[model samples]
Target chain A: MNATASLDARGKSCPLPIVLTAKALRELNAGEVLLVRANDLAFVSDIEAWCKKTGHELLGIVSESGFLEARIRKAA
Target chain B: MGVTEEALLDDPSAEPQPSGVFETELRRLSQRVAELEARQHSLARSAAQEDKITLLVFSNSLDRLLAAFTMATGAAAMGTRVSLFFTFWGTAALRRENVQTKKSLFARLFGWMLPKGSRNLPLSQLNMGGMGPLMMRRLMKQKGVASLEEMLALSRELGVNISVCSMSMDLLGFQPQEMIEYPNLTYCGVATFLERAATGKMTLFV
Candidate 1:
């Protein structure tokens, strides 16, 4: 499938990483995936909560070295 | 034992014998118990402090672009639980649609004629029209200050949650689909944010 955009939220905090990810997704159409990077420890739960709160789907959350790379699908 | 009364009265400097040593030992034990109780009390207080979580709330205003970005990154840097909400024109400033922001007459005219989103927000703290903005921009440039876009980008990379007021969007006749695809945006009304902010956390109206 043709991929959309990618976002890196590494080292970002409560709302910033999410904000940047949202901005990237805003530039894409539905069903597009955004690659995100974040090192904020809170992102583990924060992204989970965002998905629940906004209905966005998290495709995967993987650790690269110590940082996290998250894949998100724009559902709504 | 009968001689002890007379002896005690006659020689007060006599070595303390084991006869009353048990009493002395009991007193010492009681003193130690008191000390332990005091330590326990202090330890309980310290533990309570350790259990408490810090929370900070930031309000993003239309003109407070840099401030909003700074607050997001700063609070996160401090490891405080942070939440920032964008409302009204604040949401307008974050138009993921990259729509030409409707600011000046020229911008509005161009916005209507072209596909550009709302005009990028002009910094309220600094505007080139006046000396304040001019000085601020000069200082920023000299100090290597990041642009508003750069700050927001860093803030998002740090995992800040970005919210757009749903009511504001409706009033402006804007749709989410019209904007670019960003994973960080949350659509909520003013009431929604307030309900969450009522938890004794920081609530800023910036």
Candidate 2:
């Protein structure tokens, strides 16, 4: 999937990844997709719930070799 | 024997025809269920409507302060409004290092005995004469975890409200000028904290 912006939150622990993702999303326009990469396993469920609560659209999530990548579209 | 009564007695599995009173009772039960369901829905809605967290920081230990700040920043990151009310010993965490203000003899002595700032706070357990905090800070740095100071800075950047208990400050002789500069920092009494906490979805004392 194509993303308008990307964030590398690898090696960051819980809350930091989610925190940085929220910060990064603020810079994107509505409907713009953000690709977030993180190693924290909690980020998967955390981002899913965060998106649901914040009204963002989670396009997809993929687990790479050691990191997980999530695509999220900003809410309009 | 009446046909309906005979059928009910002979075939216990038979469904009884609803009489006027039975029908009325069934309707009443169905209505009650609907009302309960509606009430549940409204309760959940109200729970979700509250998105603020209020934390009472009462401990000045390094470990406890770390937990408090971590929770504050974590909640703030998830779009929740967070307020930290520092009281008593916790207010010492906000003191600026090497910044001294004139105070009464007892207050000056109290300040001298307490940790100067976030960096100087000792560990609550396994302090080992102040070596524990040093070891913990080094471990956090090596593991890419944020230290207490970094978390404090991040909490400020994240717009977490920090309220210093004025009564605690006055007792400890800590002046507002001696505290670290932070955005949204306020000096207030317990009433202010209680008022904000009333509307908060979560309140913690640490």
Best by TM-score: 2
Give candidate 2's error at residue B87 in angstroms: 0.6
Best by DockQ: 2
Candidate 1 residue B93 C-alpha distance from true site, Å: 0.9
The lDDT, on a scale of 0 to 1, for candidate 2 is: 0.88
Over all chains combined, what TM-score does candidate 2 have?
0.82
| Candidate 2 lDDT, B1-206, residue by residue in tens | 26755665677555555355457777999999999999999998767646899999998999999899888988887789999999999999999999767789988997999999998999999999999999998988777677888788789888999999999999998899989999978999978998889878889999
Model 2: DockQ score: 0.52
lDDT (C-alpha) at residue B107 in model 1: 38
Error of 1 at B168 (Å): 0.4
The residue-by-residue lDDT of candidate 1 on B102-181, one tens digit each, is 35565354334332222334445544544554465556655545556666565566566666777766655556765544
Sorted into a CAPRI-style docking class, model 2 comes out as medium
Candidate 1's docking class is incorrect
Q: Which sections of candidate 1 miss by over 4 Å?
A: A1-76, B1-63, B96-119, B125-138
